[model samples]
Target chain A: MRIKAIQWALSAAVLAMSASAFSAPPTPAMLSNACAGCHGTHGESAGPSMPALAGQSKISIVESMKGFKSGERPSTVMGRLSKGYSDAEFEAMGEFFSRQKPFTTSQTLDRAKVAKGAELHEKNCARCHVENGKEIKDNSPVMAGQWVKYLEIQMADYHSGKRKMFDRKAERMKPLSQSDLDAIAHFYASVK
Target chain B: MTIDRRSFLKMTAGAGAAGVLYGCASTGPSGSTADVMPKTGRRVVVVGGGYGGTIAAKYIRMMDKNIEVVLVERNDHFVSCPFSNLYIGGLMKDLSPLTIRYDKLAANHGIKLLQAEVTGVDAASRTVVTSKGTLKYDHLVLSPGIDFRTEEVKGYDIATTPEVIPHAWKAGPQTVLLRKQLEAMPDGGNVVLSIPLAPFRCPPGPYERTSMIAMFLKQHKPKSKIIVLDANPDIVSKKGLFLKGWKKHYEGIVDYRPAKKVTEVDARSKTVLVEGLEDVRGAVVNLIPPQRAGQIAVAAGLVGADKNWCPVNPTTFESTIHKGIHVIGDACVAGAMPKSGYSANSEAKACATNIVNMMNGREIVDFSGINTCYSFLSAKEAVEVTGVYKVDKEKNTIIAVPGTVGVSPDLSELEAIYAESWLKNILIEMST
Candidate 1:
């Protein structure tokens, strides 16, 4: 009877493991579906102010989410939303967004501002952003083809100390005026 | 009682003839017959094509293409209430932007669109009787939205006198009517807007409506005033921001009176009677009556002890009363979740996930959702209230996570821009 009891326990343990194995872990697509409501489908936003998340590097997305969750980043809504997810979920979402096609803005840009912003980008941002902010190397998110208005808001946040910026980028941005930032936004948006 | 082959054959023939005759007789004037829908291997029948129902249908198909999803809605097109106030405020020139056709849901997502009213649900048989025909389902999702409790207010019948005192709550023809009344009123005319009690659909909707009407009056008729009779003790949502906006933009134009319950309405005289205060007259009366779960839910006996809203398992949104039936949107009693379009959309996604899991014989996971409701203070500025929620399995209820429930720091044009984006994105998510 003792042997039978032990055998029964062993089978129950095996059954539990098998049951868990049959239930697959949630995929990145599943984890990121909730973000589509405001961020647009596949992380491509339709509005100018809401930033598109498509094709952003995994590290950039994770870092931004961590900042939002920790209150290190000031946001209108993301600060509250970020608290709902875990680091693991954020990683999954980052990986999902990284695999999507990059966003291309349909908004019209000021031609003169774009030209001026190109000079500003080459002077300050191109070192890190690379390829006129089109390259996603060095863990930087793709700035080219991003929404112009959203880029302007981020610059404003950094200027106001509402958002923390890395020391090097902050130093580079400190000398630029608001119009220069606007020009930079136009320059990035003008990219295909 | 055993039957031989010859006797069984006779019985089968007789039954087949009767079945054919019955099928012929049951065909109605609408060219609908009983049990006309062809059965797929696994089918989910979603009634009502509002925010919740459409999302549920589309996501279910997106999650599992093999599972057939049929979306039944009375209206051929969807008119979003989220931005209807803008249409009424004249920020939008027409209702075209607010309206969405169900064609994409059918063509893009492979959802079978049925434009029919659901008359009854036979839970025991797992069949839904609609105006068109009876549809069988492996699972059912009901998101009929809200129906007014018109009986709560004396001398108010929405059916008979919708134009006289337009509630405009449901947004469509009523929205146009309210806009027209505002346009026709004299420059200095007083517009009376009544608010219903709590647990109503869109807690901040009336306040936003008040703001929009105030905007219209302020621009078109400077002397015009809006008398807001709120049934609640105070503003139920984004209280400080709404108050600040009213004070800053519409100091004298918006006369907000809280704790004043609307008891009756004299539609002919265009007067509203308060429980304790004197009767108030208006050039245009926007009386928003109390609401409950939509008629189909009430008829299906899905409502809980409150006899108002349906109760469901927070994780799956499946009806607590019926085994295979799920209820969502404004019809369900979602803990700590306001009855907003965003909430409904969130609930639908969670519900769709579980329904797909259940069909695949997978374990159902817990529920987590986010709700963000944006209210425009003006054409250019808006405020938002958001909450991140998770289910407490022990309590069998959903609770907002700590530090995740908050309103916007202040109203701004930036949020207004986000608000438009939110609507645009959600519509795309739900429809496409």
Candidate 2:
């Protein structure tokens, strides 16, 4: 009985040591499987309603997910998806998407307004969206060459009752004038 | 900052090893090995591992070596309710530091830590049935924490906890869930947070959480804003401090809408429709709905028909309804004292001391002590209030013993550092 007890204690100690060791983060495949449901395959996102996730900064994506899980950010969709995922999974997902080539922003604008829109876009949006409105692969949205109609609709929907999104980072567009909106749309859509 | 393996072990093992080493080495040879042995070995079962149950279990073993304490908690870890707001802001990362492993209790303090949920408490037979096994106890201390009355809000239930707005009042999966929702949302999305009326656990919790969310939006989602729909007319504790932080740090960053009660939540449409206000289209919604004691309290026929909380004797914390069962934490009608971790910890100490005194053939102390609640405003800054309460003879309520309280000075860089240090030290004391 005494020898058995000593062996059991030794096993417990070994288990504790092993838990501390080999704590390397979860692999990218594990993260891809975890995030593929909501974020879609290759992190492209399935629909317009779900924000596109092809090229988001790894730090921003991890932090945002952490926020939702911890009550810093509150959403049902992200909340449900974030649960059961370890912190290492968050890092892996962020790194995987950050390395992928960014999707080309779709082209949709008239040539007449592109010049005026360029000036406005450079002044207002360049602080967050750098690299010719393409966002350097993974920071903000790829405003360049995105659908003009979608951009116009989203800007107008900010103050209106039809659309309600809550990423506080994007609230700067809330007070944009119609002319300011038109100029930004034309400039971004002209990219690529 | 990359942490090496050696440093990490030192930081993590500092508390647990220090406690046991002190227990055996500090005292004389008589107090060393002799004191380490269990004297009573009497089975004392604790349900929750929050402020009350965790402190009670630790202190009970400290006072008498013989008492065998078995703490059955559902979660594998314990998260501090005090500084949870700081977590909302990007100030503190990795909630693992804020949480403590249960292994420390069993390893250092000789307490049996069971990671299982207790389903029923057989008071008559004196057996607590958990998912694992039947635990027989001589004295039972229940501090299972509060449970939200989800039925009060329309279209909201336990399933909504992870899917829609996560009411992360209870930590773990819910906390992780809320964080993910925040990440997937567009920058200009509408975030709606509802604050229920007074008498809930942690009165200032809702405001602090809202403030942190606002701070996050200001920096990252600059165009996004938060709408606070509060049921109460005025803010509860630390209203001035939280208001100052909001106006100074997050001014023009978010909107503060008060006195709007959330009537129903449409999980399907992702909307929370409040009474006497506009229908809120929230990309992420945090419905901090109504709350009541845990299911065990109601099952044991402890709570009154008033449907508010269970009543207990002010002197002993013994349940008014049940004889053997003792109610502490948020479940009981603890007068005047706010339902906070500090108050619960203080009450647990008093109850444990009294129980021990009775068993050892001594008198129990009836005097009241201090009850302090510290709430973090920003990651660094904290505002705290302490109340020295005494039971009123004629009124039969716990009244604040006049002029026996103190508040921290106004916000400063120094104050923030102090709050951070206090949070770390307190978590260590509570968990280990």
Candidate 3:
């Protein structure tokens, strides 16, 4: 009788542990997967045009999704995606993405382009992005390893007024020359 | 510091005679000099010299001169939240313009100002213990302000902060540090600014900072963009104005986002992970985590067990938790009221009046509240919305009265000049 009672107790403990783990769900991993297209493998984006999403607060993230869905927080790409998720799902998505690991980009560029980009980047970009593009970390997108094509698209968009987003910085970027834009994008892509 | 018996008696006689004469003079003309003159020898101790504390201290002197006021602040100087964005944008040369000096408070206003951190408060004892000394009070007012609660963020501490990313909420070194970081970043470098959960000091502050940084980037680094990872779904204040500014100014340059929270920080690899997205990497990261009441608030048993802010009577700004200890500013759970300087100023005035009535054995009247939050779209143009509020018995929170608030749509040249002037006037009103 004692042996049977002990077996039952052990079985109950195992079941309880497994049940709790299962109920928690893998929300962060799921959100991370969905975010990879624009935000890159980690939280790094293709260029300065794409935003970093590594370490934002859960409340801001959830609210932003609701805004995009409701058309309060305006976005060309996110507004559509935001419509697909409910409040609970948005919350879960924010929670999940907020927890995922921040990854460095994999893109690289030639040294000559980097040298030229470095000078221009220092003149205009360093004021907010941090010196050497290495300081002031978290939530801000990493320019390293992002696709050159994606960077080019964003720059052209800013120049041609395709993506009209909120920020004085973006408006300032709209008037750059093609070579200057390419050089800076390549420089950032080579940060890693 | 003790006065002799003879001098005390003489002073008492003079005070009594003056009081009698003043009372008799009240029968004369209305708004007479005697009627407006301050009653003498009343000393008031004001804790926390932020928006609330500064306004209370300055107003006390402005209203009357007889009462002696003492202001205790942890920091030597205060950086204004209103125009800090300009500093980040590189459109301005120095942040010193945003800082208000308290030297004039003592010299011009005759306020006894002390720079010290309050460590403990004894409600029964009616004494406040600071690093310098214990202070007795006729009525005590506290506005200890805010501090971040980092427990929510994994693998992070104060030292690691401002090293990778700077949360320049409190100003001072952090503000300068953040500016330095931005100045050094390459043109196309990745810059991340993490927005913390709601109920933090300055609700629109993080977004404003983001805009300023974007302004800097737009001019110099066309290839660089800002990724805003916010914990809220939408923008809170002057939403339309910010959107308009972003669209017209930033255009395709900004990758704006909301409703995403950043849960962790990987310092070694310089990566930030959003729950549903791939790892976001940054050449630079500004991780703004969650926040709670400052340490002094919690230490005084002002905060609840849930670790949220303390509760207060909306009309009086007195602590619901402890009697004789009023918790003002960002430390209280005043619902629907975003933590801003303007709100704190209004709350402080109401709190001061209530304290005066309590001391004088007069009936305290309940008052309506007011708030105005102005956001400068740039150095030149600004937008604002004002609201008037009263306590709702049904909801137990401050509710807006209908038709009390309206946004400032037209940014006329005259309004722009007024906005700039208002910054200086308000700063003086709070500090002097």
Give each model's whole-structure lDDT: 0.84, 0.64, 0.63
Tell me the deviation in Å of residue A161 in model 3.
35
- Expressed as tens digits, the lDDT of each residue in B89-183 for candidate 3 is 78668888789878876677788877876766655544455555555555567887888887676666678755766777776667777777777
lDDT ranking, high to low: 1, 2, 3
Cα TM-score per model:
0.89, 0.61, 0.61
Indicate the worst ten consecutive residues by lDDT in candidate 2 chain A.
A17-26
Candidate 3 structure, TM-score to reference: 0.61
Docking class of 2: incorrect
> Scoring each candidate complex against the real one, what DockQ results?
0.32, 0.01, 0.01
How do the residues A61-91 of candidate 3 rate in per-residue lDDT, one tens digit apiece? 7776776667665433455455545688677
Cα lDDT for residue B36, model 3? Answer: 18
Candidate achieving the largest lDDT:
1
User: How do the residues A1-192 of candidate 2 rate in per-residue lDDT, one tens digit apiece?
Assistant: 465356445533432332113122324633442243224334544323233456656876787677656755543234434543558867877778767665443444666678877776676666667877776434355555555654665566554534444555346666667877887777776777
Chain B TM-score of predicted candidate 3 relative to the true chain B: 0.85
lDDT of 2 by residue, B1-432 (tens): 323334422432463432211111222322211212122435678888887887678767766777788888888878876666666666667577678777776677888887776766656545565555446666788887788778777778676444667887876656666667766779999788888877798887888788788877887788888888888887876777778888878887556677777877887777777773568878888888888888777665667776768887664566766554667888878787789876777667656654454444334345253455656666566666666555554554556656444455554443454345445434554555
Model 3 global lDDT (CA atoms, 0 to 1): 0.63
Chain B TM (all candidates): 0.93, 0.86, 0.85
Better of 1 and 3 by lDDT: 1
lDDT of 1 by residue, B162-240 (tens): 7799999898999999999999999999999999999899999999999999999999988899999999999998999
